[model samples]
Target: MKKFIPLSILLATLGATNAQADFQGTPTTNAPSWVTSWDVTVPCPVYVSENQADNIFFEGGFDYQDARKTVDGALGYRHLMSDNKVMLGANVLYSHEFPRNHQRISYGAEIRTSVFEINSNYYHRLTDWKLTGVDQNEEKARGGYDVELALAVPYVPSAHFRVKHFCWNGIASNIPTNPIDDLKGNTFSVSGSVYDGLSVEVGYIDYTSGNADYSKAGGERFLKVSYNFDIFGTHVNKATKPRFSNTPYEFERMDDRRFEKIRFEQKVISANKTDRDA
Candidate 1:
């Protein structure tokens, strides 16, 4: 819209920088090519049967992420099992992370078969997670979880294969501070699909494990652009093919690993970069 206000003032005049430690981030909001980073899906309406699992649908997703200012909202439900190839899903999530503004709630589940897909997610951090901004809260435990495995090969359905595992500051509440849990992360990406909604991805995130510290190494490359929707016309994957957390590049790669726990829990790493890890 109006070229997103001069690319949001050139990404707020380039905020975080340190060349992004190799996890790839180099000022990008996709130019006058603005969509201002979005992820939206709406699919509600059902009734058409032959007992192919009755095929029900209900979807909703709202996300805004331009490198780090992430905002998310989602509500979902999908089903198509009855021996018709299987498909199941559930979602409920809310996120707000920006410059360490922390706020979170998450839950996800999935199951698919047509070419295999499995996803699981859990992130919790309702406040207090600042890294350079303050508030440690003992690394604010009790938040982090991810596991995804995807593949869609077999005549090139659109090309896909994803593998992900991440854990950032987990389990340990009731007030404490400083564990950071090494902020584990692992990623792999490959996606290509263009026609129905939109998708494009390229992945790599393993900045030498945990606390990303790479000056210019061999790891750190991630890029993605995703969009999803099916509002009033409702099609719902036509039967199956959108599980991995709303598949549109795996929901921005598991919502950008919850903003990489404030972008790699900084040790001096910041820059207007993008390749997918907020």
Candidate 2:
């Protein structure tokens, strides 16, 4: 009963929290002409040009620990293709210890379609519990892998210019250990925001595994909530025709030597300013 209680409580809390996080505004194309879709997950790096690369996201949050508080941090990257119809990215998360005191790294990729998106994630948990000649209480749980496949669809896209809804289904499991494997399961998620760059996600998970007969009845469920921040990329169209104007700052690549001279003059001006300030 005690074992079941901890899992039950965790699912309830995170699930409830994620529901609130899913409340975001409608999708907008104004973000960037190159952006394919709204970034609902961690970012992944994809290079589009010699100088144009994808943006990555960094995240942190708080949780409970040995009768106190703890913190968790994550980082990820995302990229959009030229057609602006496909998106891809990856992310990793690590949380401090509560009872076991360990760190976990999770990374995966996501592909987006017009109607839905598919996600494949892999994670491993690492802990320092014991050593060959160390203290008995110094044992550790090294590394393990978890794989989850999820399918999500945007239902309403955006409602009242305020809320957005999405539904997902798939399976998740610990591939390394059969004890924590989940054979069948599904997840429900929603997201929205009060303003740009500020949003939330609410998720509920229901899963069943081979050990369900010996495990708790009703399978298992969890709730999660999260906020996201965005970093944008800068890109230029090198293949396009050039347009020049007779302005102090207006010039074309045809006059590269002339611009080089201008750049030298600007450097001299900047150096003079530094000297005067000094």
Among all windows of ten consecutive residues in candidate 2, which has the lowest summed lDDT? 262-271
Query: Which digits, one per residue and each the tens of the lDDT, describe model 1 over residues 123-227?
Result: 766764345333322122236677878787444445566787765553332344422223456667666555455666555555434432322332344355555
Off by over 4 Å in 1: 1-76, 81-83, 93-104, 109-111, 120-122, 127-139, 142-147, 150-163, 167-182, 186-208, 211-278
lDDT of each: 0.45, 0.31
TM-score of each: 0.26, 0.42
> In the order shown, what is each candidate's alpha-carbon RMSD?
17.2, 21.1
lDDT tens digits, residue span 183-229, model 2: 23344444333333334334443433323331232222222222232
Error of 1 at 186 (Å): 4.3
Worst 10 residues of 1 by lDDT: 255-264
The lDDT of model 1 is 0.45
